[model samples]
Target: MQLLLIASEVFPFSRTGGLADVMAALPESLVRLGVDVTVLSPWWQSLHGQPTEVWRGSVPHGGRLQPGAVRVGEVRAAGVRYLFLGTPDFERPGLYAEDDVERFLRWGNLVLPTLQSMGLTFDLVHGHDWAAGTVVAHARAAGLRSVYTIHNLQYQGRWNFAEGAAWSGLPAAMLPDAEFYGDLNLMKAGLVFSDHVTTVSPTYAREITTREYGEGLEGVLQARDAAGALTGILNGLDLDRWNPAADPDVLPMTARSGKPANVAALRAEFLLDDAPILSAVSRLVSQKGLDLLVEALPDVTRDWNVVVLGSGDPLLEAALKGWAQHPRVRYVSGMNEALAHRLYAGSDAFCMPSRFEPCGLSQMISMRYGTLPVVRETGGLVDSVPSDVGFRFSGGGAGDLSAALHAARLAWDDRPGWQARVARGMALDFSWEASARRYVDVYRQVLGA
Candidate 1:
C-alpha cells in the first residue's frame, strides 16, 4: 500500500506535542510492514537539519492565490519520506499563529500537486487534525480515499467566516454546519468530507459526539458515527526510544552490575536531593491538569522532591515561579529532550493528571523507562498504563491526583514494591508492532481489500 500521511508536526524535524512522536513512529512501523509511506509537514526554521532537496513551488486555491512561487524542501527519517512545505511564513519559531490560516490554506492547496510533482502515488491520503483538514477535502474531491485522524477536536481552526470561505473553495451555502457561530471550522471540514474519521481513543470518540467535548460539533460527529465512519485507535509508543535497560540516557547496567548511577547523576544535574523524585514533563496548560497538580503540590513536595519541565501559558509559568522558594521543587520552563529522559530515569514517579487526555505519550514513555505513572484513568492513560505497573486515579479531582500520588509515594517507601512496579513497567511492550497491524487493518478496510 502507498500511503500519504499529512500532519503539522513530526519528530526529529518539528515537534509541539505527542503528535510528532506518533508521526515519527507510525510511518516507520508501516514501512516495516512493507508499505510505502510518505509524510507531509511544514518546514520551520527551528528544524535542526538540512533537507535532501529544495524546489520552487506555487499554490492556488480558495479565493486568493499565492502566485509568487515559494521554496519547498524534502528529507527522510526513520524509513519515512518527508516533504516539508517551506515558505517564508514557516520561518517563524512557532508552527501556527494569527497568520496560520493563510499558511494552512497554502499548504493544503499545494499538498496534492507537490506529491504529483514528485511522481508519488498513494492508495490513501491520511491527514491529522485541523492543519491538514483542507488537504483531506481536496483529496476526497479528487476521488481519492482518505482517513482523517482527529488528534484534538478542541483545537479546530476557527477564524473569520470570510477567511474560511477564502481559504477553502467550498461554497458558503455548503458550509453552514461547518461554521461555528460566526467562524469557519477546519475540523468540521474533515469530519464532513473525509471517507473515515478516527480519534486517538475510544472514550474520546464517544466524548466528541456529545455537546460538551464535541467543541460544538457534536451533531456532525453524531451524523458521522451513525453513518459508521467514525472510529478510535489508541496511540502507540516507540519502546525503542523509551526503554530503560537499553537507553543510553539511563546507564550503570543494573543492580547486578552497579548501583543506580544515572539516578544520582540526574539528581545532581537538577540540583535535587538524594530523595525520591516525582516529575511531570508536559506543557503547563490547564487541560493537562496543571491546576490540579498545583493543588496537590504542597503535599507532594513535603514528601518527595518534585521537578517540572515544560513551558506554556503565562499563568502556569507564574505558578511554577511561585514554587521556586520550595526547597524540594525545581521547575524548568522549557522542553529539553535530554532533560526529559533524565527526569524519566531519576524520578521515582511520573504524574499525568489530564482532565481529558486523547492518548497521552508521557505516561507510556515513563512506563517504558520504569518510572511508575500516577495518571488519571481517562482516555489513553487507561489504555496504556497497566494497573499492576502504575497507580491510576478513577475520577477528576485533586483528591484523585493526590490519592494516586500517595500510592506512588507508598511504593517509593517500600523498596520491594517500588522495584516490583518498576519491573512491571519496564516489562510492558509499548512497541508499534500491534498498533502497526491495526493500522494495516484500517488501511485494508479503506481499500476494500
Candidate 2:
C-alpha cells in the first residue's frame, strides 16, 4: 500500500519531541513491511539532509496578493521518501510560536499539490497531530481517505477563531469542528473529519472518552467510539537505534550478559562514585509531573544518586538546576540524543511520571537497555510497562509521586528481583513491525479492503 504521512516533526532531520521520533521510525518499519510510505514535513533552515528533488512553491490564502512561498524537498531516508515542505517562517529558531497556524496552513497546503504536480499518488493520507490535520481536512474535502492519530489530546491547538478563519481561508460554515469554547481547536477538526481516529494506547483511547480524561473533547471521542471509528494502538520502539547490544551511546551490552559491565561503565561516565544511579531524560514540564518528581527527590536522593537531562519550562529548569547542586544530584540542561541513550543504558533505573502520556518512548527505550522504569500508572506507561516489568504508582498527584519513588527504591534494594524485572523488560519486544502491521490494517479498513 502507498501512504502519505504528514507530521509536524521528524527525527534526525527535524525534531522537538517524541512525535518526531515516532514519525522517523514508523515510516521505516512500514517500508520494511512492503508498504510505500512518504512523509511530509516543513524544511527549517537548520535542516541539513540530502534530498533527491527540491521545488519552490507558493500557497495563497484569503486572496492575498503575495502568497507564502516555501522550498519543498524530497529526500529518501532509511528506505522511506521524505517530502520536506519548508517556509521562511520555519527557517526561524522556534518551530511553534506566534502565527503558528498561518505557517502550518501554508506548509499543509503545499503538501498534496506539490506531490500532484510531481505526479505522485497515494492510497491513504495519515496526519499526525493538529498541525498536520489541515492536510487531512483538505483531503477529506476533496474526497480522499485519511487517518488522524491523536498523540496527545491535551495539546488541542486552540486559538482565536477570527485569526484561524482568516488564516485558513475556510468559511465559518466549514469550521464547525474547529470551534471550541469560542476558539478554533485544530485537533478537534482532525478528530471529526478524518476517516479514522486513533490514540497511542487502548487504555488512553478509553480514558479520553471519559469526562475526567477527555480535556473537554471526550464527548467528541465518545461519539466516534459510538460510531466505531476510534482505535488505540501502542506505539513501538525503533529497535535499531534503541538496542543496548548495538547502541553506540553506551558500552555495548545485551539483556543477558552485559549488565555488570554496562552498569559499571555508566557509573564511571556519569561520576557516580559507588552510589546507585537513577536518571530521568524528559522535558521539565508540569504535564510530565516534574514538580512531583522534584518534591519526591529529597527523599529518594538521600539514598540514590540522580542525573537529569532535558530542557523546558524555565521555572522547572531553574528548580532542577538548583537541586542539581545537591551532593547526589546532577542536572544537564537541554536535549541530547546520545546522552539520552547513555542514561537509558547506564542508569540503575529510569523515571517517567507523566500526568497523562499518550505513548512514552523513553520508558520503552529504558526497558530495552534493562533500565527499570519508575512511572505513574497512566496512558502508555500503563500499557507498556507492567508491574513485573517495572515500578509504578497509581493515580496522578504528589501522593502518587512519593509512592512510586518508594516502590522504585524497594525494587532497587531487592537485587535478585530487580534483575529479574530488568531482564524481563529487556526481553519485551516493542519493534515497529507490530505497529506497521496495525497501520496497514487501518489502511485496508479505510479502503474497504
- Report the number of clashing residue pairs per model: 0, 0
Give the candidate number with the greatest TM-score.
2
For candidate 1, the 10 contiguous residues with the lowest summed lDDT are 252-261
Model 1: how far residue 9 lies from native, Å: 1.6
Q: Which lDDT tens digits does candidate 2 get at residues 1-449? A: 88999888888787888899899889998898898889988877677665554666554431332353655778876789898876666778756787777677656655676677567888899999989767887788768899999998888777687877666655466687768999877888889889999888888999999987899999999999999899999999878878788887777887677777877876777677776788999988877887887877878776688889998999889988999888788899998888888888888888888888888899998888888888888889989998898888887777777677777777788889988998899889898888889988888898899
Task: Tell me the lDDT of model 2 at 22.
Answer: 94
Q: Tell how far residue 333 is off in model 1, in angstroms.
A: 1.0
lDDT by residue for model 1 (87-135), tens? 6667777665787766786667667776666566889999999998878
**Of the candidates shown, which would achieve the greatest lDDT relative to the real structure?**
2
Error of 2 at 334 (Å): 0.7
lDDT of all predictions, in order shown?
0.79, 0.82
Q: Candidate 1 at residue 244, lDDT? A: 63
